[model samples]
Target: MTRISTSIIYLILFFINVRFVKNQQTTNFSCEPRPTQADTTDKLQRLRAHLVNNNLFAYVIFSEDEHGSEYVQLYDERRAWISGFLGSAGT
Candidate 1:
């Protein structure tokens, strides 16, 4: 009856809202502030030095919590110190 019709309308609205939210989250990420030649060279040299100092044959990976529970700012230093990715989920 009227109650069932209202329930169907509510369900449709709920699904539409969910789809809109999901679409909003879809994004394409690109590196910002593209590094200058000198900056790139410096980063390369720093990476080399890190590898040499650590005697590492393979790149090291690191990660931080993505739950947004901890202070993500605190991990900025570690990200700067590392060569590879530093993310909440995957490194």
Candidate 2:
């Protein structure tokens, strides 16, 4: 009886682990389209030069304004200016 219960418990745990892993893999899948070379080539070159001049390895651009507002004005669209992605998500 003890061995039977242990085996059942192990089987339940194994299925739960498999289910969790599958759920994680599904959540990791992205449908967003990747930026092509035509979309970012020239812009990235200018950005890279600016980074090198400032001795910085990377820079993060946000779509928010001074008030933390996602709906920003044309002047505050820094991320769009660089990446040409005017989506709601910020970089």
Candidate 3:
């Protein structure tokens, strides 16, 4: 498929995934950084528990970059991956 069509398809799937995640997860997906921080922290706590079970003390988290790039690459879609925010401006 062409680039535009591919992007459109991805967008459609993104919305569907967002809906499913929002319903399944207690935290609502948001672009607001502060709100998402709490959500991420909660998730991290659960992850930390898993890590502790495996005898780990810490883990690294790489958040999405917010440079002035015109478009966000599929692989660098950390914001979408974490909080389900479709907008690139979201951190």
Candidate 4:
């Protein structure tokens, strides 16, 4: 093959290899053990009790990402600490 054509082929192959490697570097997720329903309920109840003790009518919980981005990451889920809701925006 011509040198130019060989170089182009090598360039394409290089990019494909780089992309494959990059994809491999992405985060891997596996099924992880989670809190039971009773445990979650107890946590919420305790939070309510704390609020009542403080005479607060209501309270809000917010979670922040490691980067403090407007969008919270799954690992940084604040409300999930108690409410179990995975939404980005919630009370």
Candidate 1: clashing pairs of residues:
none
Please give the ranking of all candidate structures by lDDT, highest first, separated by commas.
Answer: 2, 4, 3, 1
| Candidate 3 residue lDDT tens string, 8-78 | 66666665665464345444456556653434555555764675579653342233336736665788766
Give the winner by TM-score: 2 or 3: 2
- Taking all chains together, each candidate's TM-score versus the true structure is 0.30, 0.47, 0.30, 0.46
lDDT of candidate 1 over 1-91, digit per residue (tens): 5845755665666556655543453334474544531224356466656755796433433344455345656555354444433344433
- For model 2, name the residue pairs that clash: none
Worst lDDT run of 10 residues, candidate 3, spans 56-65
**Alpha-carbon lDDT, every model:** 0.48, 0.61, 0.53, 0.59
Best by lDDT: 2
Tens-place lDDT per residue, model 2, 1-91, is 5845755665666556654543442233345546552255467667666756786544545557778774689998877777778777433
lDDT of 4 at 35: 56
Please give the TM-score that candidate 3 achieves against the real structure: 0.30
Residue 81, candidate 2: Cα error in Å is: 0.9
Q: Which of candidates 1 and 4 reaches a greater lDDT?
A: 4
lDDT of 1: 0.48
